[model samples]
Target chain A: MISPVKVWRNQKKIQKILGLYGIIVSWTKVHVPPVGFSSQAPYVIVVVKLESGKSYIAQLVDWSENSLKTGQKVKAVLRRTKNPGEEGVIPYGVKFKPV
Target chain B: MKISVLGAATTKFGELWSRSPRDLVMEAVNEALDDSKEISLQDIEAVYVGNMLSGTLGGQDHLGAFFAEELGLHVPAMKVEGACASGGLAIHAGVTAVSSGIYENVLVVGIEKMTDFKPEEVAEALMGAGSDPERDAGASFPSLYALMARVHMEKYGTTEEDMAAVAVKNHYHASLNSHAQFTFPVTMEKVMESPVVSSPLKLLDCSPISDGAAAVILSSKIKKTGRNIFIVGSAVATDSLGLAERDDLTTIYAAKEAARKAYKMSGVGPNEIDVAEVHDCFTIAEIIAMEDLGFFGKGEAARAVRLGQTRLGGRPVINTSGGLKACGHPVGATGVKQVVEIYRQLKGIAGKKQVKGAKLGLTHNVGGSGATAVVNILKG
Candidate 1:
């Protein structure tokens, strides 16, 4: 299912695309759409490709974070653990770095 | 030091009624005893048992001592475990014991009782073998491999068709194996249409949960038949416990390390090997393993498989025993079973699955998600 973070990103992208089209139309198919059935598991895997030619599999901790959208660029930091008593830390999640 | 496998035996790969864990071990032991008439239990000074999930799968624990008691051997007995590679690791220990002067002869048996548990329960029990218990929360075995499938596809450009080809190849080979868990050949289309167990990993891509046993006898004294295959090299390695800890999810570090050591000790490159039986627990695993083991260049195993280069009569025959994917991965028994197939092929007795002029053979066994690996090279 599309995360709310993704929904907001889609709204922004669609607004820009509509502006380029030079027409204010009702909601288009490019707008944020409802996601289908998906599990509510606390942890989710997000694959991120960085500018350094490195990729990472990280866990999304902040489900409500608006910056956690598909196709958005973010930097990753390797960590020790995702939860208490976890065996080892990993690159838990990615966040948009301030320009 | 030269270590020779005198004989081997294995029960049919499937649900075996009227046979308890003791019965399975005894049956294979008796077969090995018969095969090794020149050397019997009187010559055997020790026994090593390879069993995984026996306590949860068969309601039996302390199997090492129990196996020796059933075989009526008073020798020192021990058990070794490495998830699915338990059998291969056990054989490595037996070979060491025989070659190290600790024993003239040693017995190594690999057995698993998978039918004892229901299917869903078996899946749960097997899932505990991977690193996902801590990360994915409760990801099943299929899901872990599915993730592997996804990552391999994303990184190496591996496709669903490529993964299905592994199953198709192994299934065809399994059809020729009388004792395989899956005895029917499958086509690429059939594999593609199989029900999805997890995204990208179909039911056909997964090995069956099976109950079976495989055993081998090792001897330091060379047999007069000149038929014995010498264990030229053997190596085992461990990888990071977590998949996320690896540099590349598409590569199995344990397999890469063990294959390197085995090749170094044997003084033979992958191209020099005549035949192989690699761990194909999942379709994606076999694809990644081919690159990791130096059988093919990175991202080239799929092309090699597509060209039929790994078939029985091809460049390097892999998984001629059907592999775990189609041959039934009786966890503990899988490693030994691979060795057994190699031994038979090297002896030119593998019948339909035999690779012509197979003087040198190799076997690769992986535990859970490449956590543990054992590779052996043999020459007749």
Candidate 2:
């Protein structure tokens, strides 16, 4: 359950990283997830080193097995980070997709 | 450097459903006092409690006052939190207090009650140690370690079998430990066949959520007796909260730095450590800990572990108490338990798991994914 104000504030920061290009540094498939994330079980998370020389960790969305390898090119995108329960704020954050 | 551990004790580690946190604390603290013989509850001038989840899971805080009152002691007390390193940090606090001449004798206890909640809830609570970004990305502890394991494998040709060897050896050591969570040995096949919690990390590779407590009595009043165990070195270091910010994924910089400081402070290097108890929250963690602690070179710990170089009868026997893998990881209790195990080894009272002629020992404790590390060197 995310605070609506915190989610709103984070969205402003998320906008900066959106659409940035990066290369994968490392990756893993999460078979077990924490609360508010069970709906996205078995998701791939990657460490990406952006072209701007910054590093980020985000879910590898719209990916294939081939896209999970190290050094794979990726682009950051906005996605729903968690499933907010009824009357809760739906938090959105940066995720990566194969370039 | 003047701090000495007068006594140490730990309750059995496992899913202790019947015991409350107060129950566990009483047992561990009383037993520790009994072990000291010369030191009683009245001798304790201050108290430090190390814990992680009492507020989030149990809705209770102010553990220092809570435990102090529980033991009927009137003294200055406070709680210490550094994720999983809470216990080690508390021990460090005790050392600092004694070294600063603020108090002669102090009691430090680390405890947690994790079995009271569901697995998912516990997993979520544990993530409080990590960054909010990691939580948003749904990266559990296993997934975070799995990310590191993949990098180590790609760079060093480390295999799952190599990681499984750690579980096998630790479980074998656990079989000799009466207080361990899983008092039975596990085979490589069993570990290899266990369900994958995260790719390349199986169920057996991860330490179980447990409930227990460990306590130690630190004193500057060293008796004239020849068998006083001293804390030769104590140090801690911190790094980025998330793995993404780290310059290297294969090594924990905090552990390396903390070990370096501790070793330098103790005037003892890796080769001189007769026995050790390292944080093995995950199989990959133990492997990386060996490298970070300088027990083995980068990309060499996996093979050395597979070759039985750290096993009992081997040089500097590691995790003789079965480690977190089989000893049960009660988060806050783990770091303190590591110290207790080493204390027993140095006292030559570890029973079946004792390292023969063990004179010096080390304990390593880590919080989150390489975020914080605490290292302590002990000599008998």
Candidate 3:
């Protein structure tokens, strides 16, 4: 998932930066029980691998059903996900097929 | 017996530049004294002061003693605390003292100076008032309200938009109130877009931490030739302090019971309330208060807000002085400050936010959700 700073700083600029890296990702939904439904939609919890070879929990966003698998490579994008007055999202669930 | 508010005064509702807690108290106390026609410091037989967090917020103990010395009043001065409802409770104490014939005129002041502490420390200190010190070791006040917001969404189908709409409406009203802490208007989009402090609750939905004071002089003696707002009814009730012990999480039981008693005493119903100043430490709390106070039907308060039915021109305008959401909730001063707004509206002194033909008004001050509650009815 992209960072909130990236999503908020420059949506178009972040998108262009990710495009150069050939990364594609989309939103998806996940459900963890006990608490009821939320209008904010489901979230995708992600882990990212970096140059240090350490992985961290990536950002999550609401997504639809049955779009992801166990192991997938994707790039993040900065986009407006919810209310206009809010900051843009760095939905980790947003993933694209890695070339 | 009706209690007349001969005079009312409040210090600015935010952090002070060069004032101590006692200074804030004196500022408002002096104003109230100035507003009174014939009342003097010597005429005040007793004194009641409300303070929420002197020990924790400002590291001061025996606060009443310090404040009384500043006023040069050797009269019996005592501090009354009911969490956030301290100010209202102090007023209630003064009213009882005068109406019981023990004293003809009584002075009540609510004061808190909180900017002395860092924001995080203040939050921790305020949260301590709500629970057994051991139980609240891990949770903050926002987390408690967040849990309630979750339950409200599940039980009553309340939406985040509905919550944001409350912030927008209150901010708009606050813009008209010159004394409000946040005098800027906010939009639903703006509320929703603001960074989320807790799930389903954002920065806009929460009242800011502040430092201020308020005072009201209640007299049992009806003025021979002057005008004043009378307190026809005042009722306070207590509920289980712990959230886990309550029957429900979405509603405040003590507030409902106290409101019932207040209405019974005032001989007025929900429809007769021209204006109200309710505790809205969080946007969800106000939504819950509308239903609990019987201003709207259960589960419909959010809709009432979205439809603009609680605005200035609506059937019953709520929080015209910006409420705790926009008006700074200075802990001790909040309850009396609420009464001050009601008095201003009933007397037609609320400049841009006054409701037309407002003969009756009410103020609801609840402490730590449902633990302690005070409901007062006012009439001109």
| True-structure lDDT of candidate 1 | 0.74
Alpha-carbon local distance difference test for all models: 0.74, 0.93, 0.74
lDDT of model number 3: 0.74
Ranking by DockQ: 2, 1, 3
The CAPRI-style docking tier of model 2 reads high
lDDT by residue for model 1 (B1-380), tens: 46888887887797776677778877888887777667778787888999889876667788888888888878899889988889889988997787788788899999998887777677656755765322333345565566666767866678899889899999999999998988999999999998776666778888988888888989888888648778888999998665545666678989999999999988889998888889888898898888988989988898888888888789788898998888889899999888888888888888888888998889999887788899999887
What DockQ was computed for model 3?
0.02
lDDT by residue (B1-380, candidate 3, tens digit) is 59989888777787776888878888888888887766777787788889888987667878667777888888888989998899889988988888898888888998888777776577657765564311211234554565567668877899999988888888888899888888999878888897766555677778888888888889987766666699999999998765544656788899999999999988989988889999999999999999988999999999999999999899789999889999888989999998888888887888998899899899999887578999999998
Determine the TM-score of chain B of model 1.
0.97
Candidate 3: residue B200 Cα off by (Å): 2.0
Whose lDDT is greatest here? 2
What is the Cα-based TM-score of model 3?
Answer: 0.79
**TM-scores computed on chain B for all candidates:** 0.97, 0.99, 0.97
Worst 10 residues of 2 chain B by lDDT: B221-230
lDDT of 2: 0.93
Instruction: Return the lDDT, model 1, position A81.
Output: 25
The residue pairs that clash in candidate 1, if any, are A80-A89, A81-A89
